[model samples]
Target: MTTFDKVVELLVDAKDCEKDSIKLESTWADLSLDSLDTVELVMNLEDEFGIQLEMNESLKTVGDVVRAIDEGLEQK
Candidate 1:
């Protein structure tokens, strides 16, 4: 699957959300994800993609997470 698809899957699993509901512009708040949820998601993404992802205020949307993962994978 693509990076965006993988990120969407992770979020869907974590938040029990519908797959179609997740979009690139969807924010953490839109998914009802709190700090812990965001941290866990990052850790999961790191493990899944074999990259180090730092959770920060800059990561405001699912697209940001996908971009971070894509960049990390490119560096690999």
Candidate 2:
């Protein structure tokens, strides 16, 4: 699976939500993800992608997380 697909799967499993509900435009708040969840998601992403993400406040959307991981992968 692509990085985007993997990220979506992670989020879906983490939030206990349907895969169809996840979209690029979907925000953490929209997905009912709290601060703790966000941290856990970040950790999961780091482990899955084997990259350390510099936490940023601007990462509020699914697309942001995908882009961050994609960029991190490129750097690797």
Candidate 3:
């Protein structure tokens, strides 16, 4: 699956939320995820993508996460 698709799956599985609500523009607040949840999700993304991610405040939306993963994969 694509990066966005994988991110969506991870978020849905972790949060037990619907896939329809997880768009690129969707923010953490929109998904009802707090800082702890965001941290766990980042760990999951690192393991899932086999890439390290330096957590940042700018990553406020799902699209940002996807972009980070894509950039990580590119570096690998």
Q: Which candidate number would show the highest lDDT if scored against the true structure?
A: 3
Q: After superposition, how far is residue 45 of candidate 3 from its true place, in Å?
A: 0.5
**Candidate 3 positional error at 41, Å:** 0.1
- Most TM-score-accurate candidate: 3
Error of 2 at 56 (Å): 1.7
TM-scores vs. true structure, each candidate:
0.93, 0.94, 0.97
Candidate 2 residue pairs that clash: none
TM-score of decoy 1 = 0.93
Give one digit per residue, the lDDT tens place, for model 3 in 1-76. Answer: 8999999999888888689999999999999999999999999999999999989898999999999999999999
lDDT measured at residue 75 in model 1 versus the true structure, 0 to 100: 94
Ranking by lDDT: 3, 2, 1
Give the poorly placed runs of model 1, Cα more than 4 Å off.
Answer: none
Model 1 C-alpha lDDT per residue in residues 1-76, reported as the tens digit of each score: 8999888887777768789889999998888888898898999999999999888988999999999888899999
lDDT of 1: 0.88
TM-score-sorted candidate list, best first: 3, 2, 1
